[model samples]
Target: MTPKIVIFDWDGTLIDSVDHIADSLHLAATELGFPALERDAYKDIIGLGIIEALQTLYPGLAMDEIQAIREGYGRYFFSKQTTPQNVFAGISELLAELAGANAQLAVATGKSRRGLARALESSGLGAHFAVTRCADETRSKPDPAMLMEIVEHFGIEPGEAVMIGDTIYDMDMAQRIGMPAIGVEWGVHPRARLEEFAPAAVASDMAALRQALYLA
Candidate 1:
């Protein structure tokens, strides 16, 4: 059955911003005199909240160090250019198709409120979403808090909603709350990794994703 509400993850799933994000994190860490890991290392933490990502990347970080890295990351991230072109090809059409089918669209992202706002504005995709929840506003992914809130906001049961994302965090959160999840291969995590979370389906591209959502 087609879900009434479809919640999307912002960075890797909707837009092609993973490389840019990884770059920003590397620059930030390097600026702070911390050794930056490979791009894949940063990519692994893409769906987590900033603080959580930082903690995971550099465990045992002092509070002050975390704050410093956060500031540095923000500076580098915003300094880069972003446009509607960054949105994955066919995403706009896919979103429109979902809305046309009477499915409510929303965003559940690891980005901060300000960061998401900027991306939404720049991408011109904000109008497509019925609502959005940022990492800073609630418990991060794999926790189910954000997804639960989105479900409540729409006055629907967890089973009536579906989450679409590129990371295992998205899958784990949905699974924890009895919501179906669809994973995209184009995102940070590999198909095998996402499969471990038992997603309803793992899509390799937009066409496959649409089919997973019953839109095809």
Candidate 2:
């Protein structure tokens, strides 16, 4: 890969926390007396920011209800998750290898700054990334603004950066800037769905993802 910077999505790309997220959404809905949803309803919005995810999850809900679900979900998720999220296989190695290669690594995630901070602190890999952009700070995924900001921060051209993620949102954002993007299969979105956004490739596993990043 000729790209000097590699941008990664957090939740499903680096860690397997969709199940917990879905569970938290479900519990929050139940506690708030909201209508029950089908299995994995929350999972469908895994790559979106919390506000966007909540809106997508409950489209008809009033703003007040949306806020309620958001707060409830946050409370439930943090309370139940005492341990650090389970990092995906080969993810740690991938980050270390990327850094070792002098490729700048950064996160452009839908997670809040606080949430990302918590994960980074617990993972003990915060220093691995040179920069990070959160949904709370910028427009959500599928929007190219954050990608633009990152490249600007590094003073690199869009062609010199690649976005690695598991969702169409990530692919779309990078694609909008005419940047190369790689998708991972072991995440919330299916490979077929991620391909719809025209990612360069969608790896079925971490080894393939490493190869896609040219880090292996």
- Each model's lDDT comes to 0.94, 0.84
lDDT by residue (tens digit), candidate 2, 78-145: 77532344888778888888877889988999988888888888776688889999988999887888
Off by over 4 Å in 1: none
Q: What is the lDDT of residue 44 in candidate 2?
A: 80
Q: Write the per-residue lDDT of candidate 1 for residues 16-117, one digit (tens) a residue.
A: 999999999999999889986978899999999999999999999999999999999999999975798998999999999999999999999999999999
The best candidate by lDDT is: 1
* Window of ten residues with lowest summed lDDT in model 2: 80-89
Count clashing residue pairs per candidate: 0, 0
Error of 2 at 16 (Å): 1.1
Model 2, TM vs. native: 0.94
